[model samples]
Target chain A: MIPLILYDIPSKLDGTYWSDNITKSRFVLGYKGLPFQVEWVELPDIAPRMKEIGARPNKLADGEEMYTLPVLSDPNTGALVTDSWEIAEYLEKTYPEKPIFSNKSKGLIYAFGNAVISLILPAAKFPIFRASQILNERSAEYYITTRQVMFKVKISEFSPEGPTRDEHWAIIERAFNTYKEWYDEEVGKWLMGDVISYADIFIGSILSWLKRVLHDNEWEKIVNWHDGKWGKLLADVEKECKKV
Target chain B: MIPLILYDIPSKLDGTYWSDNITKSRFVLGYKGLPFQVEWVELPDIAPRMKEIGARPNKLADGEEMYTLPVLSDPNTGALVTDSWEIAEYLEKTYPEKPIFSNKSKGLIYAFGNAVISLILPAAKFPIFRASQILNERSAEYYITTRQVMFKVKISEFSPEGPTRDEHWAIIERAFNTYKEWYDEEVGKWLMGDVISYADIFIGSILSWLKRVLHDNEWEKIVNWHDGKWGKLLADVEKECKKV
Candidate 1:
């Protein structure tokens, strides 16, 4: 059987693989025990590479171009898929025996992920974009330029200090508090009880990103918050990753 | 099988019943075909009435007092429940025949509702608070005063016209767009597919409030947005309400 090809984005500086979107596909692959080979594409090469594979680009409501990574190609069927959610759905359909999302929880999981993304976006923006520092020269330049265009501010200005930093931290704290309250009420080791699913992977990807990008003290503060559930979940994801 | 009593806040001016919180309980009762009666309480009278029934008030993280309505009294068990989510859970437990939420989807539903509340709050605030104009003299005075203190602005300033209104509308549009994108991906008739659950009820309550408070034109614009899905869902909920 031909192995599945997972296209991922590599950091420009060290060529290390790091992307929440790509992590999602990786997590699903690991969880399902799917045999896959990673094809790391740098930031500047993403569009051309994706175009060669016929992977669809995400477009804004106004028809603005928005290129993204994490495309998967199924060699068995010769099918190409893009978008993390779509890829997960594809895996579920193609490999029904190991379902990433149960039928009953599918819509809820999708909605919950959307909510998590919305809540975490503000908090994650700085650290995530700042991680561009680790990218290779060309990729770093591309990343900075694209991000500046998106945020309408210089990358340096993205770093909030003093009152601004405190405000940003407070927002992050509130987002985590919201998650913790839900977790406490649900009383689950995993997001959806004992069994791990894409929901965990989705959240775990965010936690992993934070761990990678945030300074030790900053990461320590977040992981220590929420009664250490964040840290435990991160560890659980790492264990899952190891099984792959 | 004594009828459950749902305590709701009545509008000040016409003493009519209207509240998203109360509507949640009503929706659950209606959906489950449970026998229940609403006891109308005014704003100022809410805390004392809730206290009399031993309903707990929600407190902020800072331990500030934040009293709210929608308390349910189940005569069968003599149990008093506060908070819409809590009430739904209690009703589900008490009357297991008709489930409002599936076990697997409960946490996700809770999280989704929180996210919706967060996104819609800013857009809904002005019209919601402005609806206080319909309140009776004392209740209206109480509403304005409390809201002013909470928002740190006079009630008159809440009305966004011209550019401000446009900005607020833009925010609302973005929020609905987010929901629409999720719904499109999930491909659900109801939030949780064919079966209407507490999630739908929760969202429908918000829609109902918008219908009640927003100006005819304003409400029309919203309902017409998202390819009339909002209007259709509101109609569906109204149909469900009529069944009771």
Candidate 2:
């Protein structure tokens, strides 16, 4: 049995999907048929252990940087893997019997799907959220240092000019729309085929987050898939995430 | 030999020293000591082929909504791997003899290095670039449409804000600074060890980019590494990139 440290927030019951990767990881654990132990470390308490393990937070700490959450560790191999994509790859490689990536074609689709969740959507949107939260603070140093990445957003007219709440959701909406268009043309239902790949798990988890933030019109198309099998699993994980 | 098409902008290379996954592919081809033919497709020209492959670009027609560059296809395997990290995985699995992801420890580090390049740094920097770029335009539709996954700056930022003349060289400074601190503490020299991993290749290629955007200060660091073995290879690449 591998010891998987979930280092999480205690708010899943509140229905907050704090990290998209955590939400996705839960679904992967369930779908992959692996019964593993999850150690819940509250985010506040994660500092020392994170440093000891060379893991950082995904969000900034008190003037410190953040690393991604939901790291998978095989105590047996002493392999501590962070980053959702890396974890997915690790699990796929380690658990070839059950098979996550399974085949090359499937793996490519999974990689593409992972890129959508891991790269494109977040790069385009997270800064808007950070900028909105720190807007009125006089100490731009705190703002800039704390979120050095969002500096690019400061130059955008929308940063100082437009209302940011609308900007954040707008980015999310655009991403979803782009995904919908791609989904329609490609494998449509699942990101790859009828069978669920790691991509489905990754995308479905984010879909949960979007649903939480989106208005009815924005979420209408995305919610349909939730009614299916994987959707139910994601809903359950959302329950776990809210507990954090 | 499987015919492979690499959609790349020979002029615009990315990632840091450790990101030599693409170069590693080329290196492996060289190491296999076999002559292999590779086709280069410029960034601007990939639109039609992208659409044909069912990927949608955000602003670029026929491009993926995400920054989908360095796509590799094994005509023999009919396997098209996107994302440099994925390409490394695909190649290692397909060519097990001279495995790129040599071992579990190496794989863990390689994956970590890839994430640093692909997610963490970009997440920090891209939003600022996006907000600034669209600041004047400031249309809700425009903001929303482009927000899905913003294209990462192929260059770097040294100025207070926005892309500057020294922007490309700035990328190298920021990228090297990131690893320098890590090198001082945990592992010395290259990301994993003396022998290069994907991280080394990623860093190497990006260094190649910085070398092209040469400044006296920039070339000071470049000259140190260039005086070595890789420096020679990098000089060769610099010439090729300039030729384009």
Q: By DockQ, who's the top model here?
A: 1
lDDT of 2 at A171: 56
Off by over 4 Å in 1: A12-15, A60-62, A160-162, A241-244, B12-15, B241-244
Worst 10-residue lDDT window for candidate 1 chain B reads B9-18
DockQ of 1: 0.52
Q: Which stretch of 10 consecutive residues in model 2 chain A shows the poorest summed lDDT?
A: A102-111
lDDT of each residue in B1-244, candidate 1, tens digit only: 6888988777643337667778888888888877888798778888887788788897665887766778888888989888888888888888876676665567778888977877767766567565787666777788888888878887767755777677778878887887776566555677666777787888788888777777778889988897789989888986875523
Per-candidate TM-scores read 0.91, 0.43
Scanning candidate 1 chain A in windows of ten residues, the lowest lDDT window is A9-18
lDDT of 2 by residue, B114-191 (tens): 444653353333333333332223332343344434543332342334455345435544554444434332233444
lDDT of 1 by residue, A1-244 (tens): 6789998877633336667778888888888878899898888998988888788897665788766778899989988988888899899889876676765567678878878877867755567555877677888889889888888888877766877677778878888887776665555687667677777888888887777666779889998896788999988976875534
Expressed as tens digits, the lDDT of each residue in A6-109 for candidate 2 is 44433333443345666666666666656656655544445566777776455442365665467766675677777676677676667665454533333233
